[model samples]
Target chain A: MIDVFLDNGPAYLAGFRMTLALTAVAGVASLVFGTILAALRVAPLRPLRVLATGYVELLRNTPLTLVFFGMVLVAPQFGIIPPIGFWTAIICLTLYTSAFVCEALRSGINSVGVGQAEAARAIGLTFGQSLALVIFPQAVRTVIPPLINVIIALAKNTSVAAGFAVVELVATGRRLGQAIPGEAVTILGGIAILYLLFTIPAGLFATRIEQKVAFAR
Target chain B: MRTRMTRAAALGAVALLALGACASNGGGDGAADVDAGDFPEGSTMARLADAGSIKIGTKFDQPLFGLVGPNGVPEGFDVEIGKLVAGELGIDEGDIEWIETVSSVREDSIANGTVDIIVATYTINDTRKEKVSFAGPYYLAGQSLLTLKTNTDIQGVDDIGGMKICTASGSTPEQNLLENYPDAEVVPFGQYSDCLEPLRNNQVHAISTDNVILAGFAAEHDDLEVRGEQFTEEPYGIGLAKDDTDFRNFINDVLEKIFEDGRWVEAWEATAGTVLPTPEPPTIDRY
Candidate 1:
């Protein structure tokens, strides 16, 4: 088993690198777009809020695998051919995760009292200015934990791309585990540890931020 | 808080141990120690005879090769051969237990006594020979390609470079294609059946596996076809425990009879034979 790991470690690492790259790209894309959607939901315009709500509710209800399936089957019909497996998977991850991130941020926005939005408006600030300067700064600190959770979810969901032929961490582990008989238990254990190496840091970093911010009840 | 943590840890450990005690895991348990006196003298064949049934392992996914049918019974070329082996061993067909062993667990299933023999479309190779003994290279299957009916671009292996190809996960074809076509993208799926959709949708350029499996797909769908000559030689072998030399010999003898008496050709006409003609059965190598 050790020999298999030693011999195959580089391929596994290469696959892991692809997983991390996809997660990072998808994570940032989702955060930016999701934050925008969340802001739109809390905006003064009724139409913007309805659109944001619909986007989040529709995507969040669907399975991540089905979303990728649609990307392969439906996207091609639109003449939108994603160049490679990486982009296809990343695009799917971005769209699916943005919905959840939107909800998490919007929930944090709800927690901020309506009075805060009113106070900013009273100062003769536009709705956008009140959101960017007053409402968002406070809501972000509270939503950091949920944002981290979303990132963790994104990291794991990248494995679904393996079904569509993207060689990521879990897919690499699976190929190796299946090729090398009787060592599956050990190989899977190793793969699980590699996953922890990713997720544990996100968690620990969240704890540190929670401690540093120390928001009052 | 520290004392509470310690108590929870201790409680968790106890629960884990309790769960472990009840688990009959792979390569470790479930194979009972049969009384030596019950067997006919010293032969391993005695164990199968005394057990009243033999456990035969094969695949549960590959259509016409070794798939579980709509009625929940495993039907395929491998199944027919398994039945032939069971009948020759003085065991009734109903007494045979069919276990599904994927390529990964083919050797482990035999070593652990999960199966008396594996008739899965298992290829005979050097690396696997170290783990288990193979008898009667019953049939030879070659790696081939399955593509959309409209795919004129990828007629053979050479044209696959720079195109995405999907093979069954954990099988040899994935690595072989990757190594041969440095520019081609290879995807591994859990089952050969899973590769069909991606190929049909053009998410993948093609599906690659043993020709026998690809032929089944070609027969099922008018939209797919098995193209290109056999690119690689894959001799299908019957797997037996490493220690069971007598049992291995007995299987080879049965295989020879099947070939001589025309049952082998007859079995072929029924399953994978519907799509592919009967090729020469592989020579049984005692080694």
Candidate 2:
């Protein structure tokens, strides 16, 4: 059993690496895409806002695993994917996670005073400029904590990648534990440590940002 | 405020760097193989001779074939056969390395030398043989369609048309269901256990896999029954990498010895004597 770990340690490590990479990439992509979607939700055009609202509602109400499965199984018929499960997992995770992120950021945008955008407009700023200079900064300050929380959620959610056999952290730990029988505790402990390595700092960073933003106020 | 945000970002960078360092500096010597040749480096027999033990992989979830026992140890027919083979190679059962085998990953496990042999309830099929070698068609398995015992409309595999069936993702059964019942919606699960739970809940109309496995499930749950006779020939084999002819021949010889010495009968009694119908002993051949 110990020998199994000794032999397959690299595979476990590779799985961890893939998990971390996918999480980081998905998290950053969701933040950017979600912020834009949130901005659109509050834009002057009712039609655009309605479309953005519908997207958020549609995604947030659905399960992540189902999104992944649909993307993997159904996409090939439309030529969206030839037969790649890995890409399907990433795309689904980004889409699903971005919806939640959009809601969080949009709530932050709501918390920003309506007067700030009006004041910027009165000062001869265009709509984009008003949002970019006056409203967005305050919105970003309010949104940092929730955005960080979303990232952590995204990191943890990468475990679902294993459903498609895209080797990720949870699946790697399981495979390692199975390989080295009687070491399930150790293997899972290692996984926890790896996950904490990301989450702990992320939590700390979010709190730190929250403190700074609050201190400024 | 700007300085504080920069500090936080810097701290994040440091944390990421620490993670990167941990990854590069982990305890491994980093000399792992990416392919089957990594084992024995060149010779399978020599590698076993050097290690003084044989490593076998089997499932720890199926009841009669391989499953985790109440004692937290792996038990079942395939596991028993693995132990017998290990004993033949001059190693005690304790000396044998046991790894978890899932149907989705079993082939790669053998091909990559993650396991020397897979006694997982692996069905012998032509597609699998193209990837790895097999020692015995030791057990004959049959494909049976499983539906709720209360549901009488789906009488057999024939009734499965246009109904949703659950199968292990990427398995031959999934392909078989698609080829045979084109209109029946097939849902794939990561494991057989996943399919079975939903099957009992009626989330899926039928669960299709090997008949022996379905029989084992039926034996455990009185509410579940195997409806039709065996539909497919799913002979089971002990899997090894195709290049490991020496290991292959060794396992085959060990199997014959076990059959002759009545150890095979004992194994059947130990793992599935009660759940299965009766043991049909294979004709012995001296390899």
Candidate 1 stretches greater than 4 Å from native = A1-13, A44-51, A61-63, A73-84, A123-126, A175-217, B1-61, B68-74, B83-118, B124-133, B168-170, B189-191, B239-247
lDDT of 1 by residue, B147-220 (tens): 99899998888788888888865677876776677787787765678777667767789888778878988988
* Candidate 2 per-residue C-alpha lDDT over A6-74 given as tens digits, one digit per residue, 9 for 90 to 100: 576786678678888888788888888887898899889999999999999999999888887666555
Model 2 TM-score on chain A: 0.90
Write the residue-wise lDDT of candidate 2 on B62-99 in tens digits: 78878885446787888988877665554555557889
The C-alpha lDDT values of all candidates are: 0.83, 0.75
Query: Which residue pairs overlap in candidate 1's backbone?
Result: none
Model 1 chain B: worst 10 consecutive residues (lDDT sum)? B24-33
Q: Can you tell me which runs of candidate 2 are displaced by over 4 Å? A: A1-8, B1-281, B284-287
